[model samples]
Target: MVVVNVYAPNIYTNRRRLWDKFLSLCNSIEGIWLIIGDFNEVRVPEDRWNSVFDNNNALHFNNFIGAAGLLEYPMLGRKYTFLSGDGKKLSKIDRALVCSDFMTKWPNTSLRALERNISDHSPLILSSGASNYGPTPFRFFNSWIEIPGMVEAVNRGLNKQGNENFKDLLLG
Candidate 1:
C-alpha cells in the first residue's frame, strides 16, 4: 500500500509538472498499489461544498487517476473528509485509491473516516479483515416493543440453530 500526500502547488503549470512526475513514478511500479492521503484537490464538483468548484482542477485530478489506473475507494460514514477552520467549507480532499490488483486481492476492503478532532482532515481507517471479535452486544430499545412483529422477530433470531461451533462464530 502506497500512501501519498501530494502538495499540489497553487500555480497550474507547477501542479501539472508535479502530478505528471508522480503519475510516471506510480506507473513504473508493479504489483498491487494502494494510495491514500490528502490530495489537495477534488475529482468532482460534488467533492466540495460552500466553495467555487474548479472544473479544470477536477478534470486534471480525474485524468491523473485514470492515467495511474487507480480506483478511488468509496468512503464510509461521511460525505466530506475535510472541514474548514470555521466549519463552513467542506470537501473530500483526502481519499484512498487502489489498483485493480489490490482490489482483487482484498475484495472486501473498506475505508472509514474517523472523527476529525485534531486536524481539518479526518483520519481514515482501512481494513480488509472480516473477522468478528465477539458476540454482538445486545441493546434493548424501548421503542422496539411498540413495533409490530418485533417480539416474533427477536425470538426467531434467538432460537435459530446453527451447526457451527463457538470458534467459528468467534472467528466469523
Candidate 2:
C-alpha cells in the first residue's frame, strides 16, 4: 500500500501546474493512493472561514480534485484547519483524498484533523491500518508561552523562524 502525506504550499498561485503534476505523479504509483496534506484549497464556501473573500483558486482546486476522481474524506467535528493569526479568518485547507480502488480495498482507512500547537495550521493524521477510531484529545502546555522570544518569533513568521529545536527544548 502506498501512503502519501503531501504539503502543497502556495497552491493558490500554481493551481494548473500543481494539478497537472499531481495527476502525472499519481498515475505511476500503484496500490492504495492515500493522499493526505494541506491543500490550501476549499471545496465550498462552508469549507472556508472567510467565504466573503473571492477565492477563485479554491474553486479551481475543487475542479481539479473532482476530475482526479478522488474521495474527500468527510471531515468530522472541526470544520476548519487554519485560523487567522488575528482570529478573523479560518478555512479548511488541509484534507485527505483517496482513490476509489484504495477505498474499496482498504475500507478501514480513516483520516482526521489534529490540533495545533505552535503554528496556525493544524496537523492531519491518516491511518490506513485502523478499522475505526474517534477524535483524540489534544494537550496544551502553558510552558510553551514561557519560551524566550517565542511570541516575537511567531510574529516574524512561523515558517521562517529560526530553528528552535523543539525536541531538545522539551527534553532539556
Which number leads on lDDT?
A: 1
> By TM-score, how accurate is candidate 2?
0.65
Per-candidate RMSD, Å = 8.7, 17.1
Q: Which portions of model 2 show Cα errors greater than 4 Å?
A: 51-55, 129-172
- lDDT by residue for model 1 (66-128), tens: 998889778998889889889899999888888898888888989999888898888888899
Stretches off by above 4 angstroms in model 1 are 1-13, 132-172
- Candidate 1 versus truth, CA RMSD in Å, comes to 8.7
**TM values, all candidates:** 0.71, 0.65
Candidate 1 clashing pairs, residues 3+ apart or interchain:
none
Instruction: Return the TM-score for candidate 1, rounded to 2 decimals.
Output: 0.71
| Cα-based lDDT for every prediction | 0.80, 0.71
